[model samples]
Target: MSSAADSNSDGRRNRGMLKSYYTQGENSGDKQFDLDDSSFKPDQYLDFLLKKSSLNELMHQEEEIVQNIRSLDSEMQTLVYENYNKFITATETIRKMKSDFGQMEEEMKALSENMDNICDLSSSVSDTLQQKRSGIRKLAGVHTLLQKLQFLFELPARLKKCIEMEAYNQAVRYYTRARAVLNQYQHMPTFAGISQDCGSIIYELGNALKEKLRDSEASSKQLAEYVDLLLQLEEPADSLCDEYLISARSRVDEKVQELEDVLEDNSVDILEFVDIGCNGVLSNVSLLVVAYNDMFLNRAKANTELDSIALQKVSALVKEILHKFFELIQKRVQLEKQTGDNAILVRALDRFHRRLQAMNKLLPTAELATLATEIVYNAAKDRIDHYYQALTDHLGHCITDIRQALAAPKLISSNLDENSSTPLQNLVQTSVSSLVEQIKAVLANLQAFIATDITFAMKSTFRRPFCFDGVREGLVVRFLRRMLEYLNELCEKPSGPATLLLLLSKLATILEESTIGYLLVLVDEQFLIVQEGDVQFTNPQTLKDEAKAAAKKLLNNYVRLEGQTLSHMVRKSVETRDWLNTIEPRNVRAVMKRVVEDTSSIDSQVGQLYDDMEEQKKDRGSDSTKRSASGLMKSSKTWSFTPSTTAAVLDNSAFMTNISKLFSDKIDIFSEVDASRASIMTGIIKIVLKTLLECVRLRTFSKYGLQQVQVDTHYLQMYLWRFVQDENLVHRLLDEIVSSSLHRCIEPSLMENSVIELICERG
Candidate 1:
């Protein structure tokens, strides 16, 4: 029993210890029982169990938990501090890199500024150097001009002495040398201020030298000396003075009077001096007076001695000077001929020609007219002849050059091959073409001038009818016909584009007035010939009858040609892309109207002639009819007047039927053409609309006075409704009419009526 008690107590003690251990670990019974529950709330159980533990023990345990928490917090703080240091280091490095980039950008900007400064300085230096070089060049040119002027300054004195000594050759040589120096100086690139003064001095010196020589010729006692002086002065004076200088007439007259006094006294032993001086003075005075009568008052004396010995001397001198001038001209012409580049020579020739023309202009009024006409005629004839000669010469030269080029051995193969497409060949072709065009142009101009002049001349000279007598109408008609024929020929020529169109335009102008009449006559004639047979003259009448017949024939031909020509034009217009829209229908209508008028006129004339014939028959009375009937009976066996019963004649001879047929054919052609010209059909329709509207307007106006407020609105509406059925056309027509009415500011009622009428007519 004792042993059983001991075992039970041990078991009880073990259970208590186990229970205590579990209870210390878990405060709640549920927690103590849940040993397998890993998600149990230990903190909540520990707090509950701490309230039951010893204070010292609990305090120690609490200290240990607090220490653990503090250690974890310190570790976390160290890690955070290390991460912050890394972030700070990265930010510092980024700032340092940015600083470096900023420094580099500033350095680059400074370097760029330095480069710009350097370039600017270089450009400034270059500009300065160029300016200096230009200055140096200008200085050099000034020095050269000064040197030339120095050389020219010594010329006048030498020329004066030569003239006094009558050494013409020496005078000319000096003058030429001075002129050459002056020319060289003029061309030098010096300061204009310096050159202008020098040029004036040189011109004055040249003029003075020439004047001295001219004076020596006019007053010198030695004949040989005088002639030499005059010859020396002639060319230079003429060249320098041209027509600008007024000759020293007072000095010349004084010298002449002194010589005459000496001749009368017979005390002067120098007979040659008196004779030569007197003659020279008189001749020069005469020439001067003739050239400048406004300056000289010695015309009466001049004219008195004009046929005397003094005049003969003057004439001889004049002839001599002219000969020299012509010789110089011939020499220049020869030089030009040799050089081929003759621009300078041509200019010189033109200058002289202009001087002659000016001289001709200065003649007396009545004499001037005759002189001018003669001169113009002669000059024009000469120029025309010269042009022909020049053309011949140039052609000959070209042929020679071509032959030479062809014969050259080196050019044999190449020439033959390239000649087929050579520039020379092209140039020749171009020249020929150009020449042909120029000839046509000239001929056309001549034709116009001649047409105008001849018309005027005929009117003036043939006022009394010289050749045609009373047949002036025939003469004028023939002239017009010839002119038309000439124009037609010109139009036929294949001139180049510009010239051909110009020629056509010119021809149109030249024939404008005559053409209207001619066209009318032509249309009439063509219609007549095509409708009726050729005109048949049964009996010859007077000259008037012949003239009338001829005029009728001409009219017929003109009308026929006009119709044919118009037909061609119409066809061409239709074939064009934008035909009727581009063409002015008014023009076509005008031409058609002309043709119609012409035909109607001819018909009226024929009717008049028929009436005249009937009148003549009546004048002859019943006897004449009886004779006519008897004669008809006698010739009945031979001429049975049995007109072929083929077509029904509307009139006695079917003339009206034929005329209708001809017009019908033309209208048919026009309609076909219009049908083909689709693009222009709209334009044609518009024109038709306009015409119908106009007709309606005219009819309305004629029927109703201007003040009539009441218009036939229903009639207009009906017409518009019938004419304008297409919706698009109706809208277009309405818009056009409205816009036109707005522009014209027409009364709304009137415009509305017109539009309605147009629309109805169109429908």
Candidate 2:
């Protein structure tokens, strides 16, 4: 309490001194300015000190602080001494552990050495026991050798007795065992005598087996036994069997020769020759399989059944024969390809497919049928592939001619003369004619192959899940698709004006339309039409339904493929920017006009077709009586009007329905020409508009030139309006063309000069 009172008194004195300094005017408005003032004296301010009582109080406070520091220093020394003792104790424990580990390691090393010594001692004892066991085994081997010798000595007598009794199985059993032993011991001096006797017995057994196998009069079972015995006797009868099978190939060769002669002699029908050749192959393969079994039954493993073996061998042999036959066919096809007689090759392929059907029926098992069918299918595919390549090659040659003609510059006349024989015109005509013939031939061949060969022959023979007739169809369809690609490439080039493009597009249009029609005809001819009162199709089975479905699928594919190709060709031609390639306006106009006229004519053919059909309907009405009489005369009295025989006569209604369906099926493709024409006209208009815009911006045309262009532009707008009926677009184009032309004629210079002349005249 006394210290508190003294501290309060000192604080009051310090406050008193601060109040005096402030009163000297550091913060006051009025201030004393006496030189004698302590606040104003600098030395007096530096001498700031506490009162004497305050100094005495501070010394007392310093003594207390010194005592507290001495107390903390003592506490720190105690903590340091305690922690140092703990650290020293931990160090001693670690040192002791290290010494103990060293001793343990030395004891472990001695224990390992002792174990090694014990293992060596036990191994020595084991070696001694092993020697004794080997001695016992050697004694046993000696006894086995004696027994083998005894068996070898008695084998010859036993074999002879078995052969005498015709116990071939027992003989085989004895011979197998004895031969195993003799071959095992032949290199040993102990069995030299037995080896010689065994060899002689083997020779005799082989001779007997050979004599038995050579007897062709033996039954199949008997021959099988002899073959087994010969295999046991180790003779070269395997080679003999192969030779026997090979001998049957001579018949194959003879048939092949006859077929070749038929191919050379057009007098012989190819279909008949194919039938004979295919039947010959089947018979030859069958006979060869039988002979192979008879000669090499033992070639099969011990557990394999004879029937299974026969099937396997027959399959393999059939594959071989088919391979060789297909090879010959391929060579002939190659020759036909070279001679440009693809028609004959196509017919041959068709006949071959028919023959393949016959052969498939002749096969005994599904597995064999599958193999044979696939083999022949692949062969046909290869041939068809080659045919497509030939078509492509021929087309390539024609395209070259077209390109050559295009390289030459010949103006097309405004008035098309039928007798004009310009080099380019003649060249295009010849090339197009040649290509048209080739395309027609290819289409016919493909149609023939698909309709007669695959649909009727192959598909009928092999059911679904095993048949690959679709592959053949796909081959031809895909080839047609590929040909369109080539045509598109040829037509897409910017080598000429729309004239060449127009011509090629027309050719493509012809091909597409004709192909569709041909396919429709094939479908109508090959598949059963849903005629009136057709009970067979009322509840169609899997086969009939599948056939119809396949036909529909083919038609769908044809439509899609043709539609895509036609649209692509038109678009590509329209986008071609080589408009300036032909500078003659008359020539350009003539080509464009021809294109427009061609499209109009093609569009008009639908009406013409309908008219023709109407005329036919009229003709048929007039001849209805005669047709009915002919039908009655042809109808069999015993034949009921079943689904197949019903509707022998086609009415105008049915014909019209078919024509409508045909049109509907191809509507997408048929509409492309009009669509393409509009697109091309728009493109041409855009090019003209672009040129007119450039002229207006550059201000390079005179009044007369602008007027002439305006007249021409008006004529063009009128012409294009016939194709495209977008009145707004036409108005916009006209506005821009006329406005820009006028702008170019009324230049800034002219405006300035006119204003100056008016101003000067007014002054």
**Which TM-score value belongs to model 1?**
0.18
- Residue-level lDDT of model 2, residues 611-656, one tens digit each, is 1323333533543221111121121223243345334322332354
- For 1-763, candidate 1 gives per-residue lDDT tens digits of 3444454456556766676677676665575334234345767768765877788988897798799779756665665666667778999999999999999999999999999999999999889898588888899999997886665555555555664575655666666555544555566654343445444444544455455535534432332232333334332323322221223334454655565565555453332432444245534544442543322222343334333433343334434443433343343333333332323432333334444434333323223233323332332233333433444454345434534553444322222321133333333344344433443332232222113223221232322222122112222233334334433443344222211222222223323423334433442342221222453322212322333333333323332333344344433322332311222111122322332343333222222211133343344354531111122112112322223521222122235334534654222211211111121222233333343333333222211121121122222222222221122342333333222322222221222333433432343
Highest lDDT scorer: 2
186 in model 1: Cα distance from truth in Å? 65
Give all TM-scores, in the order shown.
Answer: 0.18, 0.39
Error of 2 at 499 (Å): 0.5
- Where model 1 places Cα greater than 4 Å from the true spot, the runs are 1-223, 226-307, 316-346, 353-377, 380-763
Q: How far is 630's C-alpha from truth in model 2 (Å)? A: 76
What RMSD does each model have against the real structure? 38.5, 33.6
